[model samples]
Target: MGLFILCFLTTGGALDYLYFDAFTPSGPTLPAATLFSLGAASMITLAAYHGGGSLILGSLGAERPDTQIPEHRELRNIVTEMALASGAAMPQVYVIYDPAPNALATGTNDKNSAICVTTGLLALLDREETQGVVAHEMSHIRNEDILLMTMVSILLGGIAILADLGRRGFYSPRAGQRLGRKTPLLLLPLSLLIGLAPLIGRILSMAVSRQREYLADATAAQYTRNPVGLARALEKIRDAAIPFRGATRGTAHLFFTSPLRRRLENSDSRLAHLLTTHPPINRRIELLYRMAGIMRPPVQNTRNASTRSA
Candidate 1:
């Protein structure tokens, strides 16, 4: 859904660009989407390597020309092992000094993506659980879901910053100087639109994130050879109230669970749950259980990873 939206927005922008070329009114012309896609793709593909390294240890209420990863040794090793087992690119790893039990992967694409985890999370789960978390994120990497998600995040974030500037334009002394009466009228609707736009974008973004999560969970189950362990890991994170201290909403969806949130008690409700990025915990557990039928593996849990994974 987010990929579609990103393409749609870029399409809209490209159309705006092409409409200006109407003066030529030439015969065969490229669609707006093609040009927009090329521009966005070129940016990601060209700058991915540098961007990935820079973002790997960027701002977390600190300053460093080049910040060194805190737990580089273990995290990097686990990630490398997971990538090898899965036959995927070894995602770069970073640690947030924050005391929240959460982790996330971010980048323009697989080539440039960075995985970040808070110190709190490092302290929270055991190595197997950590492996499950890493495996899940790797699935995202393998599935190529990062491109659309990263685009949606950048677009929505820009829209928000632009909207805020638009709002400030009204009160700033520069308002009358830069924005004429026509400008205010123009910004009025645009501001309202931007304010609400991220909400809608998030819904769609979460929808895309949700599906990737299910697939990743299935993938983790396959790799770990113990659906029960992965499920148990999720259960611990879900039940733990240790909020990930510094996880901004900008990258929260990349975590193993809702890293900063406690499990919703009413999480089972149908209507509200639809809005969540992850499938319901019960749904995830149930899906893991069904894996037995699909993958035909041994069940380990005394009760059931299905019932408890939730």
Candidate 2:
């Protein structure tokens, strides 16, 4: 939240400078513009949380399971068991009819929460692996990670919107010379600052998101007492390399894996990783294996005989 506020303030400051120095002579000065920007940011954040669940699911084309079939019943049962284990309400479950294997949890609170998974996930994962994925999402609900991610997403959107508006208004052919004509000394610095605000904010947001994912992984392991299940689920997701068709930059953070192209995970660039919401799959699997007191899972199901210790 601090990062969100800081990014908002920085972007607001740039916008204020642009208005006073370039856009309109009578435009809201620094103080008034700041207030307006703050109000806008507040509205965006409130709307995000107000009907956030519906907005998220609707954006992803998610549908409530018909619940008439045996398979759907089993899916609901897994959710019920995980919700019990995580001490959260049995959140409404929805299905996305995509070929990508992924899932997410969202709501303003535990009682209002919903979990959505793709058809691909159901087709790909075994019972234990499915339990692990469900447990990981439930952990997000337990930790209110959904709320945190939603907040970040709103702020990121605000920053991007503000930055884009500032750039277009400042750089348009008619106004491109406005800054230079009026404030020769400030044009370059201001332009650079305004341009970089969105990128910087996105990077910080993704870094925080990656950390939360690690914590969720740990918590899921604790709840299920079977880190290997999630480990295997993640491995499968990595190998499948199918992107969720419905995911966009706005909702990508909600997914268990990156919903962008498979090549995103393949990038070895340090800068590329910072902009991604998830840590590398292999690193996550290694941590889960460590949590399970095994360096790595054996070729076979050696851990299958071990039950989840109460």
Candidate 3:
């Protein structure tokens, strides 16, 4: 968040580095801290309001039951049943169009939780594979990982805004400019560093932690009673080179698989895993391998449900 603020402030300074300088009123030039405060408040306020609004609008208008796709009923039923069995309430379902296969669950809290799927995901994965993905997302909802994601975003964004503000204060009016010339070069870079702090913080925040994903996987397996289903699904995702389009770094953690296109580099490589929300695919796959043996038969077979209803 600091980085975001810094970037915002620094960039503003870098550009009109002159504009902020004008604000130092005779009384006590607006404290450089105030600019950062403004940035933090401005950016995060936008993120929270915008993020919360989008989720609401998307569900109310775009994901109405009547507008849901034909297969939505069956999918919803399965998920609802699973939730019931798990002692959790049902989450709203949404169908989104995108070429890359993916799904995500989100909400500020459980009561408001919603799940979304990409057209690409629906079209690409086989039935069991799809189940795996949904189950993974369901796990997030059940565990409140969804809420954490939003919390993280708000915090990160706020930090960036502050960082930006600080940068803006560095350069200023004639008086400030005079100070800058006299100040050590160190202060300039320090100001820039302040803005970058948020970005660094974000990379560290990554996912809910590796253990959470494992537990989610376990929960899904328990729900579906089909470790192979999820395992196979993960394999297909790992092997497929097709990209999950329209993914944002902010939302990547929301997906069952990392939304990032599979790169030639190792996920554990410094660049790949540095601050990603997901653990490496290989590690997740290995856990699945362990579960494959103990995977119990599903108490409710979706295939049977589909066939019986069809």
TM-score per prediction, in order, is: 0.67, 0.87, 0.71
| Best model per TM-score | 2
* Model 1, span 1-310: residue lDDT tens: 3353463354333233232222134523654434554565455444433453354246343122123554456667778888888787767776776666666666655676666666666677788878877777777777776655555555545444434443554577755553352334544554455455556656666777777888889988777776766665666665554566555565556666765463451165665465666676656766676665444332333334355676
lDDT of each: 0.59, 0.79, 0.61
Residues 166-213 of candidate 3 have per-residue lDDT tens digits of 555555455365445433664465555666666665675563544467
Q: Which stretches of candidate 1 lie over 4 Å from their true place?
A: 1-53, 60-74, 108-111, 169-191, 262-266, 292-310
Task: In angstroms, give how far residue 66 of model 2 lies from its true place.
Answer: 1.6
In lDDT terms, how accurate is model 3?
A: 0.61
Looking at model 2, the pairs that clash are none
Candidate 1 or 3, higher TM-score?
Answer: 3
Error of 1 at 148 (Å): 2.9
Clashing residue pair totals per candidate (backbone < 3 A) = 2, 0, 21
Task: lDDT for model 1, please.
Answer: 0.59
Ranking by TM-score: 2, 3, 1
Top candidate when judged by lDDT against the true structure: 2
Which ranges in model 2 have alpha carbons more than 4 Å from their true place? 22-32, 171-177, 182-185, 262-269, 297-310
Q: Which has the better TM-score: candidate 2, or candidate 3?
A: 2
